[model samples]
Target: MTAVLFFLFAAAALAGALGVVLSRNPVHSALWLVLTLLSVAVFFLLQSAQLVAAVQVIVYAGAIVVLFLFVIMLLGVDREETLSDPIKLQRPAAIVLGVLMLGEVLVLAGHEWATGAQTAHGVPIHGLMDTGTDPGNNIERVARVLFTDFLWPFQLTAALLVVAVIGAIVLARRSGERPEDPGPGIPAAERARPGSGSGERPEADAETSEGTS
Candidate 1:
């Protein structure tokens, strides 16, 4: 059962990662990234690292990805013109890096499997087997560690979130007010003036008929 779950999660993570790179639309790519993050959390859960899994879900999958989506939406990217053969070299490079990463992961997994490894508590580490006293207590232990020893990092993360929010707002805002133009009609004060050149001109007097006679 553990083997089956590990394979399933690994496949899901790979597929989601591929989708993130290959998807044309940025929104779809972001969604794919979310999926990839979720699969990673599942992998952590399978390894009995419940704390790491929770952090993966809360920080990466929840906060970071949501911020990415927010920025994407705020930018209002046009999906039609997004992936139209732009950045030709980037795609191949990304594929190569992804493949190399997958190879590294496989090698690491194999090495861990070969060794008779044990958790910090000296219990044998099986893929998905739970060897702890109470599975429910794992969350409590994680909370204690995070609040005690790791409190500084947690506070720093919160500060980073605040900065991100401010940066996003600044980036999205338009600078300065738009220029205004006077309307076609003359100004009220000018129209009120008697000889302001705005009102109708006086008619020209008729030619002096007496002088001609």
Candidate 2:
């Protein structure tokens, strides 16, 4: 059962990672990244690292990926227009790096399998240990280690979150009070007054002729 679960989680993690790399849309990439994070948490569960799994979900899948999505949306980039150019170098470079990473992972997995099979007792040394303690104790151990040993990293993560929140707010805000509308320039009284077609003009002409005679 454990072996089956391990294989399942391993496959899921690899698939999710591939999806992240292959997805062209940034939003889709972020979604695939979430999947990858979740699959990694499953891997952690298979390894009996429950605290690590919880943090994996909370810090990565929940916080980090959501922030990524927020930034992606806030940017409002037109993916089609941006990616229209052909002969781009990034795609090939990414593919090469991905292949290299996959090869490395395969090599590591093979090495671990060979080492595990060659063991005399045929028992997994790093398999789940019977800690004979409550799950709460495990949680407490994680908290203690995080606060004592990993405090700097934890605080740095908090600071990163703060920056993200501030950046999102700034990006989402409208530029300013939105310039006031400049209405029609003509006054209402001038617009309402009637224009003289011939009455005032002809009278003024006749008075000018009589005064000249």
Clash count for each candidate, listed in order shown: 0, 0
**Residues 1-213 of candidate 1: C-alpha lDDT, one tens digit per residue:** 777877898898999998987788888888989888999998888878887888999999888889788778766883644555577788789889989999998777657465545344454457654737754556776777789999999999999987765554443332223333323343546434423341132111011111211
Clashing pairs in 1: none
lDDT of 1 at 16: 92
Model 2 stretches with alpha carbons more than 4 Å out: 81-136, 147-213
Model 2 / residue 42 / CA error / Å: 0.9
Window of ten residues with lowest summed lDDT in model 1: 202-211
Q: Give the TM-score of candidate 1.
A: 0.57
Worst 10-residue lDDT window for candidate 2 reads 194-203
Regions of candidate 1 where Cα sits further than 4 Å from its true position: 81-136, 177-213
Question: Model 1 misses residue 152 by how many Å?
Answer: 3.3
Q: Evaluate all candidate structures by whole-model CA lDDT and list the values in order.
A: 0.67, 0.66
